[model samples]
Target: MPVTQSDIALAHHLADAAGAVIRGYFRQPAGLEIKEDRSPVTLADREAEAAMRRLIEAERSGDGIVGEEYGTKDGVTNRRWVLDPIDGTHSFTAGRAIFGTLIALVEDGWPVLGVIDQPVQRERWIGVAGRPTTFNGTPVRTRACPQLEGAVMATTSPHYFGEDAALRYLALTAATSGGHNRMTPIYGGDCYNYGLLASGQIDLVCESGLKLHDFAALVPVAEGAGGRMCDWNGDPLTTDSDGHVLAIGDPARVDDVLEALHRVHD
Candidate 1:
């Protein structure tokens, strides 16, 4: 079903509520703890998610919820809200403004709307399937990169790619590099990178080990901006996809980049 105006309004409300809760705890040393996975969690992450959940339960009681800090709350309706209260928690704790709240609506196992809200920067990106992406209320579109050689790219970090996967990324990077049109990959900025890509500030973003909440919000943002997002195997991303993901602002270069990455995996 097409996302309605009511759905879009609800998405903005959720982001506003989450942003309110997050701004209260941002960079204030509000009792940080390391999760079992070795990633840091803070009061901001928990409280922001709780605030959003409260709004969701109150406004759309029938919709399910999946979140990072908190567990899932299943509802009878096939529609679900996926939340990453603070996507770049590490950056958030380190006093950086790159962290943002990610929200996605997955209906019948497919994402239909997404929002990337950076409370600190007061910038937000809203994406709805089949609609033009908006950044701070202005329509935005992605820039074209005809080839890999001159394309500008970004990732959170190479370390997150892991040892074995790092080699695969390195090979892909080498393929984009040449004497004059060398591709210098920018590091860091998590969810913000996808928002920038949608705004045409970036061309490619490749990352691995992402979860449903991690990359689900990204799909709509990229696709709405006239780009494409898929798993490294060139499959459409869904709740069932493997963690490997790729985002290219230019559709023409997707096959070439995907084939290059596939070579490393093969």
Candidate 2:
């Protein structure tokens, strides 16, 4: 079934709830701890997700849940609410404003509604399938780029890519590093990159090792803004996607970006 107006309102409510919990802990000794993967987590991350989950259960008891801090919760319907309470816990604990809350509603393994909420910045991006993306209630569109060359691109970090994948990422940097702009990849983006792309701030974002909760919301947000989101190999993002993701503001630049991503290097 399609997402309803009620679904959209609930999504905003979820963001609001998570944002409130996150604000309480932001930069105030958030009780940070290291997870098994060597990544940091904080009191805000756990509490924010818990807050959203509660709201979801209260409003839509039939919907499933996929979360970062907590694990999955199965439901009776095909719809699932995916949550990443804080996209950049490391940055959040450091008092940086780049981190944001990510929420996506996946129906039948495909995302139909997405919300990227930055409570600290008071910026909210909403994207629903078959609708234009909006930033703080105003519709937004992706900016056009002539080609991949010199296009500004971003990723959270290089470490997300493995040994072999790092080389492929390097190839993309080299491809877009030419021309007068002579640009390299911006080092930190996380969920903010896709929002910026939707609002016409950047041209591309490519990364690997993402989870369903990581890239699920991004697809609708980017695609609704006249962009395209897919795997590095140009496949559509599904629950079954391999975690390699590429977001291009200009659909025309996709072939060039994919070619660069696959371009072999010595």
- What is the C-alpha lDDT profile of model 1 across 188-263, one tens digit per residue? 8999999999999989899999999998898998899999999887888999998888999999998888777767
The pairs that clash in candidate 1 are: none
Q: Highest TM-score: which candidate?
A: 2
Q: Using lDDT as the measure, which candidate wins?
A: 2
Name the regions of candidate 2 deviating beyond 4 angstroms. Answer: 179-182
Sequence-dependent TM-score of model 1: 0.96
TM-score per prediction, in order, is: 0.96, 0.97
Point out the worst 10-residue segment of candidate 2 by lDDT.
178-187
Give the whole-model CA lDDT for all candidates, comma-separated: 0.89, 0.91
Worst 10-residue lDDT window for candidate 1 reads 175-184
lDDT of 1: 0.89
